[model samples]
Target: MRTRQSVCARKARYASAAVALDAAKVAGLALRPYRCDRCWQFHLTSRTKGKWMPITSLYS
Candidate 1:
């Protein structure tokens, strides 16, 4: 079932993670599927790698 989180994020909901991954590939977006705790539905998100820095770092 589709969830409100999907609607809010403007992303399509898939029946399974595999389906979502397929869709992401078809769309040419490097995305990873993850289940939302709030909605309990699979959603696609871009895979990013970075370290969290303090807000003050931006100005320094």
Candidate 2:
């Protein structure tokens, strides 16, 4: 009976691990490439908007 219980526990652990791996895979795919004002690939999404607003008054 003790061995059966241990086997069941191990199976549960493996199931939880599989679930964690699947979650990570889905999360990885949802990641987007952030486009910064400088157009650098190093920056992620920023909280402040209008980071790319161009300087104007050249329409004269």
Best by TM-score: 1
Q: In model 1, how large is the Cα lDDT of residue 56?
A: 69
Show the lowest summed lDDT stretch of 10 residues, model 1. 1-10
Q: Score every model by TM-score.
A: 0.59, 0.23
Q: How does model 1 fare in lDDT?
A: 0.70
What lDDT score goes with residue 10 in model 1? 76
Tens-place lDDT digits, model 2, residues 1-60: 122444333332212434544544555632212322232222222133544433551232
Q: Deviation in angstroms for 14 in model 1? A: 1.1
Task: Give me the runs in candidate 1 sitting further than 4 Å from their true place.
Answer: 1-9, 50-60
For all candidates in order, the CA lDDT equals 0.70, 0.33
TM-score of 1: 0.59
What does candidate 2 score on TM? 0.23
